[model samples]
Target: MSQRNRDAKRSAREALRAQRERDRARAKRKRTLTVAAGVVVVLGAAAGIGVAVADHGSSGGSDSAGRVIAPKGAIGKDSLVIPVGAADAPSTLTIYEDFRCPACDAFEKTFTPTIHSLEDSGAMRTEYHLVTLIDGNLGGSGSLNAANAAACAQDQDKFRPYHDVLYSNQPDEQDDKFADSTTLLTLAGKVPGLKTPAFTACVTGGTHKPWVKKSNDAFNAAGFNSTPTVLLNGKNIYSNASLTPDSLRQMVQAANKGKKPGTVTTAPSPS
Candidate 1:
C-alpha cells in the first residue's frame, strides 16, 4: 500500500478504538449511577419501615371494650402521669404537675374527676410528671419530698390512691407543712394497704430515690418552664383560663383519634 494511505488507515483505526473506549466508560458510569440510586431508594424504604415498626411495636395491642391503664408515677421531678385506656387505645396523655400549686389543686378537684371517670371507663390513659417548681415558690421543700413519698407508695402499690389524696389535701403553695414525708405518710394512711411498715421503710429509706430523680431529670430535659403543664399525646394542654373540661376532653378525643395500636406522642400540658 502507498505510505500516505497506510498512515490514513492507521489513524482511522486508532480513532475508532478511542471512540469505543469512550462509549464503554459512559456505559459504566450510567450503571454506577443506576446502582447508587437504587441503593438510596432501598435505604429510604428501610428507614421508613423501621419507623413504622417502631410505632407499631410501641402501641402494643387493642382494647376496644375497656381501658388499660399504665401509670408512670413521676416521669420527671415535676411531672406525674396515670396512663389509662387500652394499651392499644390509641393515645397517651401526660400531666406535668406540682403538689403544692393551688391551680393544680383546683385542677385535681374540678377537672380530674372527669379524667378519673374516663380512666375508669377505659377512654384514655394518663401519665403524671410531678414537678418541684412549687418548692422554689413556696419556700417549701417542693414536690421532691412528695415524689419520694409517692415512689415509696409505688413500692407498696399505693401510688394511685396516695396521689389522689395528696392532691385532694394540697395545702397553700406557700405552706411547707402539708407536703412533707411525715404528713404524706399521715395522709397516705387514708388509703388502706398503704401503711405497712414495709412501705414506711421504703419511704424513709428513700428506696425509690432513683425513680424520683428520673422524674426530675425528665422534667429538666423536657424544658418545662412551669408546673401543671398538661401534655395530651405529647401535645401541650393549656391550664390557664383557656382550660375547661370541654377543651381538655377535645384534646383527649383528638389523641384517641390519632392513636394506632402501639405508638405514643409525648407533648407538654398547657400552663
Candidate 2:
C-alpha cells in the first residue's frame, strides 16, 4: 500500500483504541451512576427514578416479546449474525456494535474502508452482531430502532452500504433521534433502491425488532459489556494497541497464505 494508505490504516487502529478507552470509562460511569442513583432515589423520590430509568424499554425489543424475524441470509444459530463478504473466506472478523454508540460511529468512520477493501477482495468475511447498549445506558430506543432498520436493509441486499450510511449519519447518544421511524426512512433515501415500500414498512413497523432484541439479549448473556467488541479470527484485537489496518491485512494474508481466496457472492451490495 501507499504511504497515505498506511497512514489511514494507522488512524483506524488508533480510533479503535480510543473507542475502547471510552467504553471503559462509560462502563465505570454506569457503575457509579447505578450506585449514586440508588441513594438519590432514597432521598429525592420521583426525580431519581425519572433520571435513572427514563425511557427505558421505549424500544420494542423482542427478547421475550415477539416473533424473531431473522433477515435474509442471516447466518449462525438463531440467525443472529448478519454476514458480509465471501462465505468461504479464510478469515472471519466478528464485530458487535450499536447504531447509537459514539464508539461504534468512530469505528465505522475510520475502519470501514479497510474492512470493505478486505471484504471486496474475498480475503475475509465479517459477521455483524448488533447490540443496544446505548438504549439502556442513555435511555432511548435509537439503538434498537436503528438496529432493526439495518436488519430490514439486510433483507434487501443493501446492508453493507446502509450500515455505513447509518454510522455516517448517527445521531447524538442522548438525542434518540433515530427512535423515529421517519428519520430511518429518510436515511434510506441515501442508499439507491433502498427506499421501497417494503423497506419503508419494515422501518415503520419495526419488523425485525424481536430479532434485534434477541441479538442484544445474546450480547448481554455473552458477557460483553461494550459496543464494538471486535474479534479477528476468534481473537480479541480491539484492546491491542499495536493493531492497525495494515497489520490486520497482514494477518489475513498470512491466514490465507496457502489457501484459495473465497469466491465473491452473487448477491447485490451496491457501493
> Per-residue CA lDDT of candidate 1, range 1-271, in tens?
5786455444434433443344356446657967987787788788884312222111211134433212233332233343433445455567777676665665566566667655554567677666665554434454666766766666555566787888877776557765456887788778877889977765565554444445655776776655566776677765333555666777667656654444323321211
Model 2 Cα displacement at 80 (Å)?
0.5
Model 2 over residues 144-216: C-alpha lDDT tens digits? 8899999999998999988988888997777999999899888898888999999988888777887888898
Q: After superposition, how far is residue 230 of candidate 1 from its true place, in Å?
A: 0.4
Alpha-carbon RMSD, candidate 2: 4.6
Clashes of 1: 43
Report, for every candidate in turn, its global Cα lDDT versus the true structure: 0.58, 0.82
Q: Which pairs clash (backbone N, Cα, C closer than 3 Å) in model 2?
A: none
Candidate 1 least-lDDT 10 residues: 53-62
Q: Tell me the lDDT of candidate 1.
A: 0.58
Number of the predicted model whose TM-score against the real structure is largest? 2
